[model samples]
Each structure stands twice: as structure tokens, then as C-alpha cells.
Target: MTEQEELVICVPGQRLCVADKSNVAGAGTYEQQGYIYSKLAGIVKLVTDDKTRTVEVHSITEQSIVPAPGDIVTAMVTVVNQRFCKCSIKCVGDIVLTRPYRGILRKEDVRAIDKDKLEMYKCYRPGDIILARVMPMTEIHSYQLSTAENELGVVIAHSDEEIRQMMHGFGDSSEPLFESAKIIEDVVLQQMKIIVRRACEIADRRANSKKSNIINGEDLLFLLRKDKIRLQRIVKYLELKELGCSVQKLMTANDVPQNVTDPEQLDIKKKVPFQSFLEQIDNTGELLENSSSVDDVKRRRCIRADIASKSMDEVHYMKFSKARRVSFANKNRHKFSDWICADGDVTVSKQAYTILSYLAYETVAQIVDLAFLVRQDQGKMHGDAIDRQRLNYINPFTFKPRYHSKNFVMKPLTPSEITEALRRYWSPQLDMTGPFNRWSMRRPHLKLLSC
Candidate 1:
């Protein structure tokens, strides 16, 4: 049978493969002298690229989110110096992120055309909202930011009330014909009133449809959002309405199930299976007896003799002289190194290679990778395509792959296709340090592979 009959749990320092040049290491693994080893406790996976004929490990886990190079970020300037300015990243791409990512914008990166002549003060001040692209990570604490492009720069500036008053002064004039700015503001106000009125009407209609007498703040907010109101403004308006109430109190009350809060009142005991629990309790004594059998004089002697004979027979294979008699402490400390038999009837040596192969394959498959693939089918391209209205997900009403670019021309590969693509595209370049970054940096190829 081929490898990967079952999942294998790998631990740090476990050998994955005898490093040949063909075997390239992926994440959660490192290569040593002619051998590939794991660096994290995870599953092992090995992928073969058709073009490159290379193998690499893949690691999967929930990793801390951080801003990476080339990502467009929205940040607020916190500090400024002659050479560099410091800012806190508030958003990455379209996500409003938290847990502060510090960024630095150098004077040279402030503008594209001017380098030496650029002044930091003229470009930015503390509290200025700047849009920047992440530069190569230079240090651990802060990310390097560049506003060198036309679209990347101070999107909002911290202006004093005096400037605000001056800007709004045109609307104060009692003159029959005000300035162009006042006329534009009046038109915008009229449009905004109409939109808000429409949104309220929609909310009322929805409440009526639900047979509800009153529309809550949530209903109003949802209707407003559907009408294309800014999320931040909508949230602020909701906050203003609920100013006297404790939002946290309401959230907590909703989170805890009613049955859990008053189990007796809910008659939860009747719903629970008492027979299974009683059976478990009855078996606990038998389990304790079996565990204590290790302390039995006869069993202890038998185990010692068996271990002694095995160790003597395999003396030459022992890496350390002291391993001839392995201590219980050593075994306990190195429990992660203990192997489970893939084929229970056979000795470890006969099935060791098979087990290792499975671990490698699993490791490669688990680590998720992002890839752009061309849409192979033309079924979804038509204007009246039924697929367009089909819900991508059951819970969230957003389109499938929620984090895609707006008007994104490229289609992301499906999960099923990714496995084969990884196998087909497994190349030595993927073994390079920062392989994922390398993949992203390169121009995405349009040559699609079929499953």
C-alpha cells in the first residue's frame, strides 16, 4: 500500500527525510546535514512538483497575524523625526486590524521624485492618517513603510478647529448666492437626508414583515449599512442611541444559554444520558487496577527482563552507552520521541519508513498556501448566470473567498485543486528561505492545471 494510510503526529527534532538535494524543506521543518527534520510539533507532508521534481514539508497551524511586505496598510502617525516617522497600523488591506503593528516611514520614502530635498514636517505630522505599503521587514519591532507611490500618502490630516471653521465659513453667509463650496455642501446634505429617510423606511418595512411593532437599533444600523453608509459612521450613530445602556451587559446575557444559567428550571438532567455516565464510573476502578498492575512484582520483573534482553540484542544501535539501560526518567522526558506502530503485528524497523513517509505527506498537505489560478470553466461568465446569485456560504452573505480584491480578475484555486497544483509546481525555488514570500513576489502564472 502507498504511504499516508493514517495521520502521523510529528514532534520537534524528529527526522522527516534523509536530505537529498531533491528534497526541499518547507515550513515547520529545517534541513540539517543531508537530512530534513521538523522544527515544530505538527504533521509532516511531502509534495512533489511535476515541473521541479522537488519535495518540501508543509506545516499548518493558527499563526499570529502580522503585516507583511507589500501589504497596503492604513496607519496613524504617532511620532516624527528628521529621518523617519513612526506610525501604528490600524488596518491591513480592507481589514480593520488591532494589536498594534508599528510602522516607520523614512523621509526618502515620503515621495517618489524628491529624495534629498524632502522634508519630514511638510509631509507628515503626528495624528496624520497615512496610507502606505509595507516595505521589507528590517527589524522585529516595526515594519518599514513606503508612501512613494501617488496613491500612498496622508489620506487624512489632523486639522485644528480654526481650519475647520474657516473651511465651513462659506455656509454661514446670508448672501443670496453662496460660494461653490456651500452649494456643494447643501446638495450633499439633501442627498444624505433622502438616503437616511429611505433607509428608515426600509427598516420599518422589514420590522413589519417580521410582525414586530418596534424597530431596534440593530435593524436601523443594518438598513443604513445596506444603503451604503460608512460602517464607522453607522457604528457611531448606534453608540449615540445606546449611550445610557451597558452594551457589554446585553452581550453577556445573550452569550450564556438559558439552559446553562438555570439547569434545574430547564430540566437538563432529564435530557442528559445517565446510563453512559454510570457505565464510565463503574469502569474507573477496573482502569485504576490495570494501571497499578505495572507495580506488581511479577509484571515488573517481566518488563525489566524483556527490556534488558532487547537492549542487549540492539546494543550496537544505541547512540549512547547509558541507553543500554534506559531510565524511566529519560523515557518520560523524551515521551515525544516514542513511536507508535503503524503495522501492529510487525516490528518497528519493518514499518518505520512507511510511517515516516505518511508523516511527510500529511505535513505538506496541512499547511495552507494561497495561489491564483485561472478560471477553467466559462459557465459562471454569462451576465444572467445563476451561479452569480447562489450563496457562497450559508452563514455569511459575503461572496465566496471573502478577502478577495475588488474587481479581482484572477480566480483563486479551489482546495481540491491546490493539492495537485502544489505537487505539480513543487520546485527547488520553493525550498528557498522565505519560500512563501518568494512565491508571492513572482508574477502569477496563468497556466492552469486540471485535477
Candidate 2:
């Protein structure tokens, strides 16, 4: 063996050194066939305890925390009655229980001060998960559970699943669960912790309910989010459990938040509408017309355009015609360019119109509500006329487009009229130094007629 290999760390089942008359196996190591093998995957150390040297492997994995008497555990109520309630221990302290231990919370042991006045059915119901203290073993079948303390009681219930789901549905991220499951797990876990904490706060506000003095779900979530190593190990343990594999794991420190000593602060922002855009537009389009320079006008127009885009919805009207194109040699067949030409009267090409006409002719149902279609001819055209349709009205409840009674779009202003208006109202504001400064002499806003 090389000199570096002799001192390197090792994993489980790796042979370290010979365990003979002088050498012996220590903790985290096992000896067989005159050779010592590491029992744990960790760093190997040679310790001279009382002058007797032995090799040992110390694992880096955190040790598992087990439930014991006097420890606080979070349990879910499975069966509840007037006499007692049965629960499955979900966690011991801050560590989640991989294997849930059964526990029984007797009615008499629910509260210390109000034992006589309190009713088990009134206080806790089935499916209500609680935080309780473990009592000394009194029953052979289950661990004795106590919630007599102020902080120990039902923190969550089955009825609250909808609220939990609502929180999980936030950010519209539920669809990506299959794509990135770990991310969903982390997000859901964080959301669940927040919901549980809120519920606890609400419960603590009750007149009869005592102030919670125990660690909450938020604390557990904080530990899981901040400790990547621990989270990975936990996930590994869960994965092993599913695969029926054996795993030896530990929790290094008691994973609890340092700020758990104080109650969490709550902040809620009120939803309000942005009415500044509407307020600016109320001046009869003065903001656009009164601009001192082209830059100012451009800036205002861009701002207005952005606001308009946000309020307006884009609608794609699908062409449903299905007329097949006839051969070019046929005199009855229209030319290819004619089929795709655009006009103020017909937005779609003759080819697209043929299909829409076919669909309209064949189907009894209206194709307007169906899938939206785009014309290949218009695809290359920047700022196509069809894309600039401004709706006359939008249904407030449904946000659906509403057309004018006559089903006609508003006509554009004549180029001469536009030029005259600009010269009278806008030309004086400009510096007018360049040859293109004259608005009347520039490109006319004339509509192009299709061939």
C-alpha cells in the first residue's frame, strides 16, 4: 500500500488493517479473518486508550433521535372519543419520525388545571394532529401521551387540508411536480409550515387556549431549508425505506430555530388597484398632444402602450375554412398570391378564407370559440393590420371580447387630416431643423390596397 493510502479515510466494508495479536478492532469497526474492516463509512483513527492502541472509524452522519419519556412529540390523532384519543407520533422533538410510534392521550391527562371542566370531544377531534409530551410507560401497547401543558395540543387538523392545498397552489407551480419533484417537496414543505404556524397563532388567540410554549412546524421547516446535508440525509432515509434498504443515520444537532423564543411577526399587504394610468388618460389625450419634443411624446406613448397592453388581452381568431387549392393550370383556380393577399375588407388570404368558408359551411357550431388560427401569409408581416384590432368592449366578469353592434372596426384618419392636425397642434412644439421635420411632407398614413 502507498503511504497516502495508509492514512486515507475509508467506507463501510473496507479493510483497514490486520487485527492480530498487537492490533485490535475498536468502535465503528469489526474484525474477521485476522483483518479489521470499517463498520461505518467515516474517517479512521488510531487511538491509544490506556496504552492499548486500536483503530476506529468515526461516522460523519448524524445520529438518529429516538422517542423517550419526558420528550415532546408531535402526533396525529387517529381515533378520538370521550375517554381517550389515539395518535401516531409524527416527530420526536424537532426531528420527524421515520417510523411513527403509536400513543394514547387520555381525557384526564389533557390539561392539568382544567381537567374537570374540559371535554375531550369539544377540545380535540379525530384527525387533529397535536404536540404532546411523552409520559413514563404505563401501558404495554402504546406510549402514554400528555398535552396537559399549555403549549401541547392540536396544531393542525384534517379539515385544514384545503387551506394547505391553497397555499401549495400559490405561484401556479403545482404542474411542475413531476418535472422537478425535489423543488415541489421543498416548496410544499415550506408552505405547509407557514400554514401550520398561522393556525397555531389563531388557536393561541382563543380566550381559553394557552400561549404555545413548544417548538412549531416553522422551526422544523427552517431546519430542513437551511441544512442541505441533513435534508439530503432525510431524503436518503426515505428513499431507503421505500426500497426496503438498510440505512444508519443520525441528526447532528437538535434542529430547532434560535428565534423560536419569540412569537413570529405577521405582515399582510392589501390588494389595491393601480389607477394612475387611468387618471393620466382622463385629460382627453392631452399628455400625448402637449409633449414639448419628439422624445417626450415617444416616452409618453411607450408608457401608455405598456399600460394598454397590460389591460388588453390578445385574441387569436382561428380560420376554420377547408377549401382545397385548385391546380394553377385550371382557369377557375385563383393565383397563389391572390389566396394570401390582405385587404381592409378581408384580413385572411383567399387560401385561408377557403378553409374558413369550408369549416363554416360544414360545421353547425360556431368556430369563433374554438382554437385561434394564424395565417402563414401574415406571419412575416410586421405589425399586421389584423393584430391591431382594438375591442370596443370587454365583459367584466368573463374578460371576453365584445364587438360593436354593426361588427365594423373604426376607420383610420385620412393622411391629409392627420398632417393638418399635426401642423396645427404639434409642429410648433418641435425644433423643426431637419428636412424631414415637416409632418405634412413625411410619409403619408395612406392604406395600401391589395392587388
For candidate 2, report its TM-score: 0.25
Note the Cα lDDT for every prediction shown.
0.43, 0.43
TM-score of every prediction relative to native: 0.27, 0.25
**lDDT string, candidate 2, 120-223, tens digits:** 76777556779999887787778999988889887864432222222122111112121122222232233333433433454355324776433322222232
Displacement of the residue 146 alpha carbon in candidate 1, Å: 1.6
Predicted candidate 1 versus true structure: per-residue lDDT over 241-293, tens digit per residue: 23313333444665534444454643333321122322344433331122322
* Weakest 10 consecutive residues of candidate 1 by summed lDDT: 169-178
Off by over 4 Å in 1: 1-46, 53-63, 69-72, 91-98, 125-128, 155-451
